[model samples]
Target: MAVAATKEPNRLILFTDAVVAIAVTLLVLPLVDVVPEVAREHRPATEVITGHQPEIWTFLLSFAVIIRLWLSHHKAFQHVRAYSTPLVLCNSAWLLAIVVLPFPTEMVGVFDNSRFTTGLYIGTVFVATGLQAAMYLIIRIDPEVASEDTPLPGEFVLGAVTAAVLLLLALVVALTVPGVGYWALLLLLLSGPVEWAWRRRHAVAAA
Candidate 1:
């Protein structure tokens, strides 16, 4: 790797962090800033928030999803340690997906019961996770963009792939199941155990 390629790309990471932070912050505006006068006058703000329980749930779920994505990005970039045209392009694609999340998130809040919104939300997840997975592969292929002798941690790549699979499975269940629909997205909580088992097995193997 050239000396330039080995240098840390702090600006890239900083810019990406800002973008992700802004995207996550935008999630709250639809719930609070856009309250109608009717909602404002008839009830205490607390009560109004309570009444919008489903929206709160959607907000939290979307929030968690974005945070998961950030962590995956963080993991991959630790190995990245540099930059390239393909690497920058991959990062841009991933960030594009991140920024788009808030719209579908609002749609989830507005159309909690509608299959279209739910499917759209899941579709967003599919695209985002797919982009993230591509990022991992791109970094691996372009060693000049990575730390010397470094490969992405297996657990990290597995986690990203698991997320992609989980999203695809959620979409399938949402479409096929009679009543459960997008509630299948709650299945993402299962990634906790999956990651735990992945780490446990890798730890034992390393030992």
Candidate 2:
């Protein structure tokens, strides 16, 4: 049988980091453009920030989201020394979702809170989180990607899956619940407890 080829993960990790940095930076450009308008109107410097509260809020939220996603990606790949074709494809799709996040984030500030805008923002997050979860699962199952001596922890895999599930739940609540808006994302807080319970249950079962 012909063995599949695998390469070191360094270049892939570097490229992913670069793309995530650019995406996070893009989230702030809309807010920066507001400064020129504030100056052109001879408005007080205070208004430069105070008047663009929506833009600023969206920028901060998306910045945090991207950062969290990047951290998750980092953790998922931490033990992965080799990259297969499937892992590369999955990581590329995850990056594409990260790149697209800034657009909906900008729209959230420009448009009134509604089903479509809320859905779009939450949906983008859902896709990104879901992809990250898939990466965790892939690394756990693919012997070529992670060394047997340093396999991904079952808790980390469960946490990633739990987070993705919570994000999906948040997306559904945001879309179906009237006036919920971004508040639906609070559902993510349950991820810790949920993952804990799942892990504990499995441990007990094995015992």
TM-score per model over all chains: 0.83, 0.95
lDDT tens digits by residue: candidate 1, 11-54: 88998999999999999988875467436577666765667878
Clashing pairs in 2: none
Supply candidate 2's per-residue lDDT for 27.
90
Question: How many clashes (backbone N, Cα, C below 3 Å) per candidate?
Answer: 0, 0
lDDT values, one for every candidate: 0.80, 0.87
* Each model's Cα RMSD: 3.5, 1.5
Model 2 over residues 1-207: C-alpha lDDT tens digits?
213326778899999999999999899899889889989999999998888788788889899989988987888788797888778888999999999999999999889587899899999988988888888888888888886678888777787788888989998888888999899999999988898788788889999
Off by over 4 Å in 2: 1-5
Best by lDDT: 2
Error of 1 at 86 (Å): 1.9
Per-residue lDDT value at 62 in model 2: 90
